[model samples]
Target chain A: MRGKDVRLEDVVMRFGSFTAVQQTNLTINAGEFFSILGPSGCGKTTILRMVSGFIDPSEGRVLIGGEQMNGIGPAKRPTALIFQNLALFPLMSNWENVAFGLEARGVAKAKRRDRAYELMALVGLQGHEEKTPNELSGGQKQRVAIARALAVEPAVLLLDEPLSALDLKLRQYMRAELKEIQRKTGVTFIFITHDQGEALTMSDRIAVMKAGVVEQVDTVDNLYAHPRTPFVATFVGENNVLEGKISHIQDGFAIVETQQGAIRGINQDKATIGDKAMVFVRPERTKLLNGAALDNTFEVDFERRDLEGAFVNLFFKSDTGSIIVHEANLGQHKELEGRAKIGFNASDAIVMRSGELSDE
Target chain B: MNSLIRSYGKGLTGIFVTLTAFWLLLLIILPQAFMLDQSLWSIDKDDQLGMKIDRAYSDLGLLEYDAQQATGDTNPAVQEKIDTLKEEIATLEAQETDPPREYGLQNYTRMSSLHFSIFVKSIFYALAVTVLAFAVCYPVAFTIAKLATPQRAALLMLGLIIPYAINELLRVYAWLMILDYQGVINSLLAWMGVVSFADKTWIPFLEYPGSVFVALIYAYVLFMIFPIYNTVETLDKNQLEAAQDLGGSVFLTHWRVVLPHAKPGIAVGCIMTFMLSVGSYSVPQIMTRGKSGDWFSQLIYRQFFETQNWNVGAAYAFSLVLVCLAFILIMMKVFKVGIRDISK
Candidate 1:
C-alpha cells in the first residue's frame, strides 16, 4: 500500500450525548509528516483513534489512501497506531515482539526471525533480540515499539503522543529519532500530541485542534506567521494577543483603538472596519528599535527579565495588559531593565478576525 | 547475648527478630518436618508402630543368654523393662548375648504400594484441574484485563468475586445440584426428550465419565481466574493495537503477543489452582460422596485419623507436599520465569 493519505470529512464522534469531535475536516497528503496538536481533553487522541479505526466516527467518513474507511475496523485498516504508552509486549523476546506482524501474516519462523533481526538492526537494537520490553531503556523501548509498528509496513503510521511518557531529554531525543525514522521509512506519519514543541519540531504540517474541532491546519510557518483565526494565532506559538475595535479603516489598513493608544495594522486575509477584531504580534517580532520607525511603541518599567542563554524573556505591562517580549543577545547591547521605550515595526503586526479558522 | 554484643539500641531488634523467627519456624515448619520424618518410618509388628527391628529382644519376662560362660537370666531389654528381670539376670553368670538389630528401611519400601498410588492420583487430579480451570478462566480474565472500560470493569470484577464470598462447600454443592440425576440439568434434558425417563431407566447424566472431574474443576475455577486477570490487567493496550497495526490478526496477536504477555498471569494462576486443588478434599468428597471421587487427601486423612497412624499419614502428606513442590519447580522451569517476574 502507498503511504497514508488521510481525509476526514465533517467527522463527528459522540459518546452517549457528549460529542468529542464535531465537524472536523482535514486532508493530510501522502508522506507528509502531519500532526494533530491540542490540550488535554481537547479530543486530539479521539481524532487519532478515529483515523486508526479504534473509534468510529458517529457522523463522518475517514478515507485512507483514497479508500473510504467506514466499516473497516482497526485490525482491517492499513494504518498502524503507536499508543501514547508505547505498549510493547513484556513477555516475548525483543525479536519475537518485533516480528509479531510477520508471524501473524503466516510467515515461517526462520523467515520471520530474519525479518525481525533486520528490523531490530534498523532500529539500532541489533543485539537486543533476546531482551524483553522491560529490559530496554525508555528510548530503546520506544524504538522497539516503532520497529514493531514498521514491521508490517502499513500505509500510514499513527502516533498517539508516544513519547509523552519519557522524560524531557529523552522526549527531545526521540522526537529527532522519530522524525529521522519517518524520513527513512518514507511512511506517512499522523502524529498526535499536545506538546507544541514536538509538533513544531517534527511536523511538516500541523493541525491545531480545540474541543474536538480543527482550529487550523497548515504548514508550521503558515500556521504561525499567518494564522487566520485568533485561536490559531495564539495556539500555534507564543503571541501577544490584543482585543481591539476598528476605530477607522482606510485603503486596506485599519487603525485599531487598543488599550496601548492607537496603532495601525494590516488585516490578514480579510477583515472589515468597525468590526470587533483581535490583533496578535509575536514576542520575538517586537523589535527594540533604535529610534527608527515608531508605528508601535511601549513605554513601561520592566516587571521582570529572564535570561535564557541565547535570548531574554522580558515581561512588562502596557496600559492594556501584561506583554512578554523576547530578545536575542548579540553581546553588543547591554541587557535592558527598569524602564525603556520599545517600538516594533507595523509589518510584523497581524490583525485577524475570529471566524476564518478551521479545526483541522 | 550475641545479638546484644553485636548490636546497639538497634541491636535489640535483632534479638527480637531472632526470637520471633525461632517461634515462627517452630509453629509453621516443625509440623511439616514431623510429617516428613513420620512418612519415612513405619510401625513394626511387635509394637504395632511404623517400622520394626530385625532382632528379637524382649517380650514379657524374656531373656537372652550366651552360654559360653553359662548364664540362665541375662536379658538386656528385661533389664530396661523390669527390676525383677534385672535381678534375675544378675543372679546368672551374665554371659554375652546376641545384639538386637538396629533400625531398618521398611517404610521406604512400602511407599510404592497401592495406598501410595493415592499420592500420584492426587498429583494427577490437581494437574488436570489446574489445566481445565485455566482454559475456562483465560478468556474471562483477558476480557477483564483488556476489553472492558475502566468503570464497567470494577463491576465485572465484583461479579467475579461475589461467588467467592459464598462458602466454598456451598459452591461445590451447587455443582452437585446441577449434576445430580433429578437436578435442574437432568430435568431439563428429560423435558427436552434428549434423555427420557419414560423410555430408559438410566439416563447416565450424573454418572457420566467425567462427572467428578467436572465437579472438582467447577469448585476450584476461581482460583485459576483471579491471578491471571490481575496479571493481564497491566498489559499495555497500545502494544496490542501496535501489534494489530503491524499486520497481526487477532489470532496472531494473541498467539505471538497476548499469550506471551499473559504468561506471568497464566503461570501464577496455574500455580495457585494446582496447589490448592491437589491438596483439597472437600469439593471431591462432598460432590462425589467419597464414591469415585476418592482424592489423595482423603487417603492421607484416613491414614492419620482412621488408622491411628500419624507416621503413615504424615508420610502420605509429605509425599504429596513433595509432589506439589516438584510441580511448582516444573511450572517455574516450563514458564521460564522467576517468581519475581511473574508477580510483577
Candidate 2:
C-alpha cells in the first residue's frame, strides 16, 4: 500500500549491437509522481521497462525499495505497468479485468470481485463493474487500466502514455484524474510521455531524454525556467532562438552578437568571450517595445498572425531566423501588421553555449 | 439475389448466382442425396433365378431338336411345349432386366460385428489423433504467431507447408517408410543392438494402431496449425504483457487470454483434423499395409470394391459423413463459436 523508491544504478540496455539506453543513474523518490518526457525512440520507455522488471539492464543493477532486482520477473516485482494501449483483457468484464491480479495470487472469487469493485470505485468507476473494456469509452478504459494496476497494490506504478489514445479534452481530464489517484494512493508513479504539456501538468519531477541520454531532470517549474541544454529549452516550450557568439560576459550576463545586432542576456552556461552561444527568449516575453528603451530590441517585418483561444501568436522574420511573439487576446492590435519593434529585458533572455535544438 | 446483382451488376452477378447454385445442387446436395438413396435401397435377386433361366434355355434347345426331327408335320404337344418355352423365356428376360427394388435401412443394419468394431475404433482413433495433434500444434501455432520475429515466423510457416506440396498418399507413404518393420526407426533400433534385421526380429510398429495414428496426425497437422495460428496472430501483444505485468502465471495467461481469443480457430482446427483423420483411407491403408486391422474408411472401401456391394459402402460412407457433421456441430457448441466464426 505504500510507495517504494526505484533506483537505476549505472544501467545500460542494448539490443544486439544497438544500445537503447546508455549508462545512466537515476533515483526516483517514494510517493513522487515522476515522468520521463521524450520524443519517440528516445529510450524513455526502456527505463520504464527496466524499473518494471520486464527487462534486465545489460550492464548495471535496478533496485526497488533498496533491494536488487536483477533477475526478478515483472510478476515478482512491486510494479505494475499500464501499456500504451491500456491493454485491458477484452474478454473479461471490467471487474474481472481489475481482479485478474488478485485471482492470480489465489484470492477467492467473491473477495476478488469485491476488491475489484472497490478499486474501480476508487478510480470513479462505481457502476461499470460488469461492462467489458470495449463497451466503455477511451477515458473509461483508461480508468479501468489504472484500477486494475492499483488492485495489485504495487509499490511503483509505471504508465507508458496511457492517455495518448484519448481525445485532447479526455486526455486533459484524465491528467487531473490520474494525479488525484496518485495522490490518494501514494504510489510512486513513473509516467512516460512525449507530450510536454501532460508531463508539465502532472509530474512532480520530469526527466527530459534525447537519443539514449537524460539531458535534464528537475521539477516542472525549474525545467521550464532553467533548461540546462538547448534541446531542453526548445523542446519543453516555444522559444525564440538567436544563434550568435558571446561578445562579452559580465555581471551574471553575456552580450551576444548576431546578424540583427548585439543582444545582452543572462548567461546560464557562463559563456566566455569569443565563444559561440545562442540566446533563447520565451515568445511571451517579447513585447511591443512601443517607446521603452529596453536592453534588447529589434525591428522585424510581419509574417503572419495566428489566433488561439486565449492568446495570439505573432510571427516576425529576420535574415538569420524567424521569431514569434505571444500576445494576450485583449481584442487590441487586431490589425497591426508590417514592420514592428519588439523587445525583452536582458534578464528575460537566456544565453547558453550553442548546441543541438529540438526539431520542433 | 438482389444484393448480388447490386454488388456485381446483372451479368457477372448472374454468373455468380448460377455458379453458386450449381455448386450447391451438383457438388454438395445431389451427391449426398444420391448416396443416401443408394444406402436406402436393396435389390431382390433370388438365388435360383439364374439357374431357372438356364434350365429353361436348355429345354427350349431340346424342343427345337425334336421339332427338326419331326420334319414338316409338327406335333401339337411339341408346338405347345415350344410355345410354353417361349413364354417362359420372355417372362424370365423381363424379370432379369428389372429386378424388384426393396427399400429399407437393411444396408446399414447388416454391418458385421467386426465391421462395427472397426467403425467404432476408427472414430476413437480419429479423436485421439485430433487430441494429440492439438497438443502438438497449439504450442507451435502460438510460438510462430506471437513469439518469433517476422522472418522466423515466416520460415517456420514455410517449413510447415512444405510437406503438403507433395501428394498426400506420398506423405503417408513417407511415414510408412519411417515406421515399417525394417523401416527407419527399426534400423536405428538395430544399430542400438535392440533388434536385428538379420535375425528377422525387428519391432513391428506397423502392426500397431499407433502407426496409423502417427500418419493420420502427420497428414492433418497443418489443418490444426494454420487456423490456430491465424487467430493467435490477431491477438494484441500488449494483452500478453499486461497479463504478465499483472502477475498472471504463464498457464493462467494462456488459459484466460490467448486461449479464449483463439476459440474459433481451435474449433475449426479440431473439426478439420477429426474429419480428415476419420475419413482418411489412404493414410491408414498405406501405414498398416494389411498387417493391421482395417480402418472404417478401409472397411467402406472393401464394401465397395472387394465385397461388390455399393449399397453397404454408401451406408458406411454416409455414416462417416454423419460423424463428421456431428463433430462439426459438437465443436461449434463446445467452443461457443458460431459457424460464421469457424469459416472465417
Candidate 3:
C-alpha cells in the first residue's frame, strides 16, 4: 500500500474546559516514520487521535493526502490505530483477529483467512494462525496487532505507545522490527511515545511536546545536537544546565555569566546582551581537563563515579550545581578523585533563552 | 475442608459445613425428592365403597332391630347376622379411611391434549419473551456499561432497580392497569377520539396473548439485563476503539467483539428470563384476569388446588423443570459458554 502525507493546520483540541492540545501546525511526509515524544499527559496521544480521525479537532482542519478530513469517523478514514495494550480480540484466533477488518468489509471467510495468513507471515508469525492471543507471548501479540492494522491497507498507521508494556529487551527489539516494517510497507507511521530513545532510534523526525504545546520538531541528530528550547534540551537527553545571563555576544557565540564563572557556548537562540539565558552541555561532551585549555572550564570536587558497562559517569560538585563528565571505562581515573577540572568546547555547548526544564 | 478449618477454626468450620449440608438436603434435595415421589403415585379409591358402607350400616341397623324383637333362639341367629354385618362394615370403614396407593406413570401420561397445547404454547411464549427481552436489554446494558459516564450509569442502574423494590405481583398488576380493556393506552386513544367508552367499544388488550408477554417481560427484565451489564462492564474501552480504527462498522464491531465477550452473561440472562417467564403464574394470571387462555403454570396450579390432584400437579411442575433444564443446556451450547463462565 502507498503511504499518504498527513497535515494538521492550526489544530486545537479541548475537552469541556480543559485544553488538551494547543493551536498546532504539523506535516508528516509520506513514507516517513515520525514520532511525537513527550511524557504522560503531554497531549501527544491527542494529536495521534486527531490524525487517525478518532476525534475531530475543535478548531482546525486535519488533512490526509491533501483531502479535508473534517466530520470523518475512524472507520471511514484511511488510517488505522494500534492501541497501547495491543487490544487483540482474546476470543478470536490469531488469524481471525488479523482478518477482522476484512470481515467487517464483508469479505468471505476463506479469502480473509488467506489474507490474514499472508499478513501474519509478513510479521514473522507463520505457525501461529490458529492460536488465540492469550496463547502467544508478549512480542508475538505485538506482531499480531501490527499485522491486524496492516491488513486493512491503511495509508497511515497511528501507534499509541504500543511498546510501553513490553520489557526493555523486547521493546528495543520491537523498535527495530517496527522500523523495518515501516520501510517494507512504506506506510506513513505516526508513533506516539514518551521514550526519547525509542523515538531517536526509530523515527526519521521527532516532535518533542510539553504540556499542550510542541516545543521543537527536527531530525533526531539535530534535536539532540541543537535543541531550540531548554525543555527540549533537558527532556530529549541528559544535559548539564547552568543558569546565567548573556554576558557577551560575538559571532555565533555567547558568554553566559554564572555563579561559578563565565562560560561560552554556541548562540543557538541568539539572545541579546543582558538577557537571561542557560547553557546546556551534553554529558559526553563535557570532559575531564588535565592542564589543557578549553573555552569553558571549572574546578570541581569529585563526588562519585558510576560504571555503566561501556562508559563511566563521574559526578562532581561545582559552586553552582552538579556536573557530570562521561568517559570510556578504561580504568584510568580510579585512584585520583579528590579534586578535578572539567571543561567543554564552545561548539559543544548551546545557549538558549531561559525557559521551563523537564523535571524528569 | 482443611482450608476451611484452617481459616475459621474447627468449631466455626463445623458449623459452616453443617449449615451448607443442611441447606443442600432440606432446601434443595428433600423437596425435589418429595415432589418426585408424590408424582410417581396416585391414590386408588373405589367409587362404590362409600355406597356399600352406607348400605352395610343400614342393614346392620335392621339386623339389630330384628335381634331385639325376636325370641331367644331367633335372637341368637339375628345376633350372628348382626355380628357379620358389623365385621363387614368395619372392613369397609378401614378401606375407606386408608385407600391403597397405585404407583405408575399414569399421572404423567394422563395429561389431555388441551393441557399439552398450553404447555407448548407457554414454552414458545417464554422463548419469545426471552428474545424480546434480550433485544430490549442489550442496548441498555451496553449504554450503561460503556457509553454513559459513571454518575449517569449509576443513575440509570438505580432507575432500572427502583421498580424491583415493589412486589412482583404488584409490578404485574401495574402492567395490567396499563394494558387492561379500558386501561391507560385505551384511555389515551379515547382522548384522541379513536374509541369511545359510551359505545362499549374499546381495544381488548387482555384478550390477546401479547398482554401476558408484555407483563412477563416487564417482570423478568432485570434477570436479563443485570447479568449482561456485569459482563459488558468489564470489557476494556480500548478494544472498541481498536475495532473502529480497523474499519469495523457498528454492527460488525458488536457482533465480533462485544457479543463474544458477553456470551456467558447472555447465556445466563436467557436462562433466567426463559425459566422465569415459562413458569410465571402471577403475570398471566393477573394480566389476563382469566380473559385469555391459561399458561402452563396456571394449569399446574389448577391441577393441585382446583382438581385436588397433587400427583398430576407434581408431574406437570416436574415437566416444566425438565423443559427449563433443557433450555439451559441449549443456551450453553448455543453461546459456547460453560457453567463456570456463567457463574462468573
Best by DockQ: 3
For every candidate, how close is chain A to the native chain A in TM-score? 0.94, 0.98, 0.98
Q: Check candidate 2 and list the clashing pairs.
A: none
Q: Whole-model lDDT for model 3 versus the true structure?
A: 0.93
lDDT of 1 by residue, B181-216 (tens): 677787788888777666664345445526656876
Q: How well is each residue in B37-140 modelled by candidate 2, as lDDT tens digits?
A: 99998766666888889999999999988987886657777888999999998888778788777899887888889889999999999999999999999999
Q: Sort all candidates by DockQ, best to worst.
A: 3, 2, 1
Which digits, one per residue and each the tens of the lDDT, describe model 2 over residues A1-360?
A: 899999999999999999999989999999999999999999999999998888899999999999999999999999999999988999999999999999899999999999999999888899899999999999999999999999899999999999998999998899999999999989999999999999999999999999999999999999999899999999999899998889888999999998878999999997799999999999999888778888999888888888998999988998888899999988767788889888899999999999999996
Off by more than 4 A, model 2? B1-7, B59-92
Which candidate do you rate higher for DockQ, 1 or 3? 3
Best by TM-score: 3
Q: Candidate 1, what DockQ?
A: 0.50
Per-prediction TM-score of chain B? 0.75, 0.91, 0.92
Residue A51's lDDT in candidate 2: 89
